[model samples]
Target: MHSSPRSRRIDEHTIRSLPKAEVHVHLEGTFSLLDILTLAKDNGVRLPGPAATLFDITTHDAFTAPAVTSGGGAGAGAAGLSGFLRFLDWQCGLVRTPAQAARVAYAFAARQSASGVRYSDVIVNPTHWNAWHGRELALMDALASGFDEAEQDGLCAVSIAYSLLRSQSAADAEAVVTDLITRRPHRVVALSVDGDEKVTGRTGEKFRAAFARAAQGGLHRTVHAGESSGPEGVWDAVELLQAERIDHGVRAVEDPALLDRLVGGGISLGVCPRSNVTLGISPSWHEHPLRRLHEAGVLVTLNTDDPAPLGTTLEADWAVAAEQFGFDHADLVGFAARSIDASFADPDTKASLHTELASVAASAVDATTTA
Candidate 1:
């Protein structure tokens, strides 16, 4: 069943012009080497290694391990979870000031816009930012400043998903929920979990109270599951966390019942095809479960989980889904519609995006006919 790369090629122009929404991208993973270099110098933080060394795609290889967070266990070794944490720790160290945060946020917005992403639910795990240790609100405000500026300029509209890492204590998760509910930053939309699911295992039981608090406080919930573990991880997310959406729920393919539950519940899976392959969750795009999941009535949306660090873009991710899975323009539009429907953006924003997506699809069809 292996297909040649060229055999599945999608129309790059059509996909690029198709407006889409992304719901599973991380803010920290969007830092490019240039952004990292600038922030390191500005903050007086030593570079972990040279930019060339860190950003070299060939050096990392495609980690073929299932559900391993990009740095958690797949990076150059110290091997295992600690090494990945160290890698993420070093990256988060660079942005020492609010200005640096804004810079990175702006860059992320610009990059996403280039790939036709009109809206994004960007996950920002405060636990990752060692520099912002006691100043979480300040950090959120700074990132908001950047994203707001981007929005004003008609780039991608963005909302933040404040994440709680599974490695943290349940008390810590509760604390984050309290702060999020109290502060209720204008751009903050959802409560999410971002961490090495494999290392922490199914942790929904531990953070169940916190997620409950978030739900009561009117925050939407999503969790990273079924990436490093199995369908059990996803089941715990839905049953314990009451997750409305799942990040990387690709492994649900292994469980027929789980797949049924996801479809029945209408929980969307933000499948990052390239990120899954690069992180070794799936062997390659050709073999990815996205197509199968879509065919099975599971709502699937394409995205770049951490494009800068992973050397991918939303455009490339869409292309891979089309080329490898044989999704045509109409199918891509369906994916876009699903992403919009699943997003936590304001109702007005979602409505507008839905209309925009329809118009874009119709225009593409009309142009094709004219040609």
Candidate 2:
């Protein structure tokens, strides 16, 4: 629960102006408070009491509250990531149509643009969206359409990573990957695994066949590991699932051999600082192993795991990295560069974003100099 005061060396404006890419954001977790309210009312879903009282989606600590009540009883705070996952299920459930899903995607794009995110690899667990019940492909198309619409408007460019929920069956996981490869939905970049890792207990061996299929089909691989489970989960992800990038691999700091493997293999760890604190994985930002991982030669990248639900933006994460980890502006820029390198984006797109990020950083520096 402890944290250092915000650094005076960085300001919100500067942080927002830093061009960045968000590789770990969840599409279902992108719902804003206003969007939540609108979706619930439109679908005749009742929420607990006043919107503000349900939960404060403004701070990381608040996300640790108990189960959120939907209608009658008092809304509980999010107990942990497990509780948050249930809340995510309910929030995404409110969108019962393709158009609504599109709206959610577009809204997420708009929010990311406002925070200076130039690119995003948004993850979605299709099972969580009840609206997509028997129409997963349709849901994917709608989401792609929304992202395309946003890209057309010159907002953030978007991609999708069809995530397999850990709670689901191995057969279900293979089916999702099979469908993703078969459909080849627009802007689909990779296959991913998400959900509370503790419940799943490092079942990487179970998904190897599916991941192998994805690799054969040219889709990239990334897996959620080492967040809730131990370093062994990360090891399984690398050895069995062949994850090119791991979401929240902070626990790798505990195992020297695992850390060496990550370093040698050039696997990127998409570290979400606020998420770790909110989920009780790390006691505070200062205690986070991000800097340690970076210093140890791990390809570390900063990201907002779930912006709206966690009440954190990429800009906020960068600021915290600066304030707590003593990263300078250049260091923040490097984090963005590494994200681009680690992304499943096409080479041409990656080159374009690299150029754009450099220009933006130069401009920001020039403006600071003049001031």
Candidate 3:
């Protein structure tokens, strides 16, 4: 063991795989190639592929045929796109029933366990399930069952959130919050506003309503802002939505005053750098806003918004931030702590996890020093 801070970090693996607490993974976005294929088959929904040629649901281009999806046959999606949107549509369809929701949740939880995620706040759109079951209560029941089952399997625990669509009208968005809160407040820990980042802002009244309901229901509020639009969107998400944390809030770096507000307000940022880069909202890893925000005393945490679609995971996402943002070990380790600090878990859980993280870091340092 080197017994020196400089030597410890340098000799360490370039990619640090510490125990992670993932707060931003969407259920729809967590579908593995096998999971999606299984769901598609079970739902009688035909996807574009054989097992080897599959794309995740959150794709930018249109669906390419199975052969074209893997770049085998004459690429159908060379310019325009075909069976891709079907997969996207079918992802929701597969979870229409309660049993299916439990299965997906369990599978997602199992995947997280393998990634060393000790705790996860998995985001799911109840509106998608609600629309199918004809009521919000049914969707909540299904999610509750899924979370309960995941708990039993040592995936630790899961807290659920209902995501409001940006494309929805103001009244419609309010209905989602109102219905979910009314039906199952305990099971639902947060309310998220997502979809187009362009849609995250400009809907001030809708945010206002959602925030009011979130506060009243004792649920935290968050929004997907700043990645697609400007820092102004971050402002709206924090102010209008009463966001405890802003998702993908890299654009806040462009506005110093907004950055000050974020620091002063004690709001956390749920940043997903790879997702931003892959979605074309960001230029590259080195350009991410996380390092500047962290240095400025703002509360920022790392996350993987869609892991598999971008062919990465929480570890890879953290490594990208570390490598490009010039973050050393403390910064990377702090990234994990920040997520734990911003979590919806109880004080006891937070305290215990914090100690666990510190212990893990200490062990790594000790091993290096003694070796």
Per-residue lDDT over 1-371 for candidate 2, one digit per residue giving the tens place of the 0 to 100 score: 01333344566577777777888877877788999899988989888446884545323343345543211100122254444655666777898877888898899899999988888888877877766777887888988888899989999989988887666678987888888888899888898887666554667878889899999999998888898788999998999998999988999999999999998999999888887887778889889998889889999988887777666677877887788877777777888899888888789989998998899899878988999
**In model 1, which runs have C-alpha deviations exceeding 4 angstroms?**
1-8, 57-84
Clashes of each: 6, 5, 8
Tell me the tens digit of each residue's lDDT in model 3 across 1-371.
11222222221243345665778777766777777777777777766444564663324333434321110000112222123323444456676677877787788778777666777877775544433645556666676787788788666577776777665677877777677767665467888876654423466566687678777978878777787688888888877888887877888989999989999988888878777766656666666666677778888888887665556777666655655666667666676787888877778888887888888888867887999
What tens-digit string does per-residue lDDT give for candidate 1 at 233-302? 9999999999999999999999999999999999999888877776677887778888789889998888
Off-target runs (Cα >4 Å) in candidate 2 are 1-8, 56-78, 365-371
TM-score per prediction, in order, is 0.91, 0.90, 0.85
Between candidates 1 and 2, name the one with more favorable lDDT: 1
Q: What root-mean-square deviation over C-alphas does model 1 reach?
A: 3.8
In model 1, pairs of residues that clash are 8-323, 64-280, 65-280, 67-227, 67-228, 71-84
Against the true structure, candidate 1 has what lDDT?
Answer: 0.81
Q: Report the poorest 10 consecutive residues by lDDT, candidate 1.
A: 71-80
Model 2 scores worst on lDDT over the 10 consecutive residues at 69-78
